[model samples]
Target: MRYPAVAGMFYPSNPHELIEMIEHCYMHRLGPKDMPSLGCYEKPIGLICPHAGYVYSGPIKAHSYYALSKRSDPMEETTVVILGPNHTGLGSGVSVMDDVWKTPLGEVEADKEFVNLLWRECEIIDLDETAHLNEHSIEVQLPFLQHLEMLNIIKFKIVPICMMFQDYETAVEVGYFIAKIAEELNRRVVIIASTDLSHYEPQEIANKKDMIVIRDILNMDEKQLYEDVVNYNISMCGYGPAIAMMRAMKELGYGEARLLAYATSGDVSGDYSAVVGYSSIIVE
Candidate 1:
């Protein structure tokens, strides 16, 4: 079993506290005022969300989950493929974890079949659990998913991938293969790229710098995004994962992306001198 890595740190360890914290996130001033509603039928292909502490980035993450819950139909056979940057440098350049993930809400089963298939077909993707053992980027995302599951809004098996290398070449290759295999198998896939933008910069500078990368994402230009990251030194932590998820969407014929919300840690802490920018964007 993959135990919770950031359970007590990033979020609450107690199950009750965890649930309340998630609810508070939904009701936060920056978050979507109302709870998730199954009002639409168009499924989302990909999303870009910030992976930070609940007090800092959870509201921002809520925006993405709210967008996810919009699909009116039940997500029966859906697989959530989460791609996060390897902050801890513990495993392969591109690694996938095949194990049941435990969270406060309950245990979520990994899509072993999906893992096995991708490992065989994608030469660059290695099966490694060490990368995820101490990585909070992917683990922090589970509570939101677990909250959604508790609501019976969706049911899914997850396939977690950690990218230690966020280079353009590796990201593009990984994204391409994920879409390729899912399409071949006729499987429904929803991708979530875990990221935070413009870390520890002044609010004004962070917004300006992040906007450049955000524009590239909204335009669905992964190459230009990489360029923006490199040329501007944007400090976006998960650009590689974003690039990968964007590539997968493009492969699956998604052309447009909508920015649901954008905010900074300063907004919550009232410390504008230096802050981390977070955004929630969904691809349609």
Candidate 2:
């Protein structure tokens, strides 16, 4: 069983409060919102979201799920593959769990069949739950998904993978492996890369670094993303997962990517001296 490790800290521990926080995220919107109409895209293929505290990043994350809720077919058999950074350094290079994840909202069963197929196709992936035991990057996104289910928008299982080696080569191999699994299973899959941008930097510096990372992602240049992160010292925790998702989308013939929202913790706390950046992006 995968119990929530950061519920009361990163988000609310109570289910009601959790739902309220997510609902409040949807109620508010940042300016110049340009999400496509409901039928604009057949569905969302991948998302890049932040995993910071809900108070600072919830609204930005809402754009990722809101767009998803609009286009997803409620009746389809869908599985969300979430890739997060392994901040805790406890498991394999790529750890995939085959257990139910428990949150304040409820339990989300793992897509074991899909995950097993992934393990077979990718040599890097391992069946390990310890890495996720104390990690919040992937856990923080569950309530948003649970809220969607509560509203009857969509019901789906999950494939949660945590990446400890955020390197471009590993990302490519993993991305292609995911694409192979999707093709083999012929299932509707949505990939989510969970990451928070520049951490504890002044707001201006954080934005500058994050913009570079965002540009590379929008350009769909996985190698460049890795190079920029290293060369420029961008503190994007999940760049490996993001690059993996980008490579996977390209391999699967996806063409467009959109920047839904971008904000800094300063946006909420009014403290620009040292802020963490957050952004929401979708690839299709």
Candidate 3:
């Protein structure tokens, strides 16, 4: 019964206004024309998206979802597992939510069955609904999923994972395990890593620093990605989830990744100083 935080500061508070905002982004930004159609390939195993406010990050986020829009399967037929960074610092490794997440669009029911199964298979994951409360990283993604239309017909569950102080080995092992379970269940899943790239740096500096991490990601170099973030003191908030996604994608047979789009808050607000960077990436 915990409705938690609604879209006010992050997105439009009014229901109709919020819907319009999402639609406008999708309509204007059609995503990369050079990329392969979503229907042409196997369902994406994972996606890396930013979680900044709609005004700043919405267009880039739309591009990420556009990549999935061409999938032949109905949204109802797909269960998206959105893995987001825990800004609240509550959960240790991974936190699973059993309750439905409410947004301006409507109530998004959690995939409790899948959550339970993950809990049984992985000792590092636990059910903690509190972790989801007031956490915008995961919540910001639900409206996009709802707007897809087909999602209304499919029963989808969400698993919000907040990784804390976990080593690279642990993340990789967890990713491998999730892939194995998804294969066994014969369920089509999309892993979304909700994170912004760099924070509070000059626009040029932020973009430069984020590109280094992005390059490593596109190369599928998990070690190099981690090292670059640490070595440069990069403020990319979702490095843990990105590492986890890279690990999981490799296990799922996706060896290559492409940078679909990259933009900064400065792009939207026309300010170059102290901006957050956002990028949309897909692994296939």
- In candidate 2, what are the lDDT values of residues 1-284, reduced to their tens digit? 88889989999999999887787777655522433223222653899999999988988888898878776766665789999999998988898998999999989998889999998779989988888899999999999887877776777899898999888899988888888887788778889999999999999899999999999888888999999999999889999999888888887789488899999999888999999999999998
**Sorted by lDDT, highest first, which candidate order results?**
1, 2, 3
Best by TM-score: 1
TM-scores, all models, native as reference: 0.97, 0.95, 0.91
Give the alpha-carbon lDDT of every model.
0.90, 0.86, 0.76
What is the lDDT, from 0 to 100, of the residue 165 in candidate 3? 44
For model 3 the TM-score comes to 0.91
Across 126-241, the per-residue lDDT of candidate 3 in tens digits comes to: 77776777778888988887776433323355666666544677667667766776776777778888889999999878988999999998998988988899899899888878
**Model 3 clashing residue pairs (backbone):** 76-154, 111-157
RMSD of each: 1.1, 2.1, 2.8
Error (Å) of candidate 2 at residue 284 is 0.7
